[model samples]
Target: MAPAKATNVVRLLLGSTALWLSQLSAGTVAASKSVTAHLAAKWPETPLLLEASEFMAEESNEKFWQFLETVQELAIYKQTESDYSYYNLILKKAGQFLDNLHINLLKFAFSIRAYSPAIQMFQQIAADEPPPDGCNAFVVIHKKHTCKINEIKKLLKKAASRTRPYLFKGDHKFPTNKENLPVVILYAEMGTRTFSAFHKVLSEKAQNEEILYVLRHYIQKPSSRKMYLSGYGVELAIKSTEYKALDDTQVKTVTNTTVEDETETNEVQGFLFGKLKEIYSDLRDNLTAFQKYLTESNKQMTPLKVWELQDLSFQAASQIMSTPVYDAIKLMKDISQNFPIKARSLTRIAVNQHMREEIKENQKYIPEFLPR
Candidate 1:
């Protein structure tokens, strides 16, 4: 079907359902019967409008599940052309049914790129008026103050010259506006070599403005750390030796490490571990909240389906947390070797135990409906 026709069908269905539900809510028996008959005759195969009316007539968990299932099925069928209004309607109704469901639905809507409905839903839930059109908000990643503006501009010019072949072909100057300034700095910091990795993913015809937007979004969200670790991390990890290996006398003289040095090493190790634990705790909390939302709507989801979504979230969190976990392990190992701490073995064991507990906690977020 054409996109317009499909949209019309959805609008008509929603309008009919709303009218029927409103009448049912007011306890107008005649009006309710009249709307139901009209919707039944209009959409014979799909009785969703009438079902929604019945759900409004007597709200219950079972009825709510039926309504959600019907909406889910409709959404699946309407996935073509990326039309998401149907899903948005389901989310809107889901919000009305439960607060958590509403928030999750908003998340789901954004995931599917249903920006319009998601924005509308957010305004309604937030109880705030909408911002004027063309309004924009952004997050900035602070940069070190060591480099002067002119030096940074020169670096950006060099970076742009190198990146132009891969990103855009023609000559173009970076925008001077505040909105795009951070993006330019990020691109400059990324350099040509690192930005080349994105060449395959980015289209040849993509404009500089589009690239700027993409970079801004990436810097703000940074959903996956693997890309950075694999690309930029590897580049930065290459060691540059300033001098030859130390002689025996130099090594022997450095061996006279102090008690204060050892204490400082322990403190650094403790700080690294503490930060790792905090990241783990946040991942656990997010998973737990999502799991609770899933469990509450268990009647509407299959075990396999639940596990699929749960696994996706787990993998994303794990990917993001992987860098910190590695850093902590490396810090512990480095500190253990440098200091004469007798608790090195015990600390290793404790770190392993903490990681095990974190992984176990992550597993708890998967709904019990999935296989054990």
Candidate 2:
């Protein structure tokens, strides 16, 4: 039952889609899964994660219909579908808006299908209506950058008028960051699913230099982070924004949901949870592995050392280049012990006497000759 509560976003997503999802075959979901995931990465601003699913991989559309049909008694859930259906959301950025650490945080922490944002794509989902309550967004900022709180509030008002024309719905109740670090947070009760599908890896990573701030807000209960004063690592400086918090009931009419729940079949629910975590883990691990390789490469830049000898003719430069080039490569290996792929690829493509001699030397060194 408690887990059912976790499905608040799940309810909103499934409840609203009850109409359309019922009309399609389960295979439609299966076919669209990879397509939408790929697209979500491309268009983080489009809220594809909140829409027609990307969430539609299961064969349980009948049960979703059944849940809406049966759970009509739960009045709070009646309108929970709009966060998904309303495609064009008002996203007003705060802080050095140029760097949107906040938007990325929201995407990673929820069931939404958003990736890092350059967020210009507009074709993912479409909406023709204004926000339900006339205005439907809260003030968001990097909590670490609120030194000029008064100025930011002024900016918020200006942002509401001059910017993308979304409604600003809440009074600021700046959240306390438990970690004492700097984080971009939504002060409003956006009610992101308690633990994002990727929270497991994000959580594990948080312990290690804890790059991720464990995003733990459930449906209806808005939560925030503890952040540092500067960009990162230090404790967050909490200053009172002195504005009132938004009314909890305001979200009562705000509807959203995830794809895992009793509303779907048991197989669907289990797979939704397990599959998302597994896929998310692989994504995170692969990223880390790539980073490892990148670091191992030590980001070495192969300088055009020959350029320094520009006055020399091409033939003269080419003649002495062998010894210097050999020296440079050997020095790089001695220092970093890892050859970047580009260097390796280039070496393999054009192996020379220097390379051949070095390989033979390495083989000879590995089994050193006995002292006479």
The candidate scoring highest on TM-score is: 1
Summarize candidate 1's per-residue lDDT along 1-372 as a digit string, tens digits.
Answer: 699999999999999999999978888766565321111111112222222322322345344333433443342333352435654554455455556754564454344333322222322322222222332211112321111223433343344334322222211223223333223322210112223333222212133333332221111111231211111112224466788766888665465233223322232222333344356766644543443343334324223444344334333333234445645665546534633332222232222345557878868987775886
lDDT comparing candidate 1 with the true structure: 0.35
Q: Which candidate is the best by lDDT?
A: 1
- Number of clashing residue pairs, candidate 1: 0
Please state the error at residue 317 of candidate 2 in Å: 3.5
Candidate 2 steric clashes:
25
Which regions of candidate 2 are displaced past 4 Å?
A: 1-59, 76-128, 131-316, 319-372
In TM-score terms, candidate 2 sits at 0.16
Clash pairs, candidate 1, are none
Query: In model 1, how large is the Cα lDDT of residue 299?
Result: 27
Provide the overall lDDT of each model, using Cα atoms, as 2-decimal numbers: 0.35, 0.32
> Model 2, range 1-372, lDDT digits (tens) per residue?
888877987888888798567667676876676421122222223333222221111213332222222222232332464643332222221112213564455433333332212112112111122112321222223322222323443443333233232222211112233443322222211212212222333333344532323221112221132211112233445587799878676554342122222112111101333344456775644443443454445345555355433422322222224335645454344334433323322322223556456656777777666675
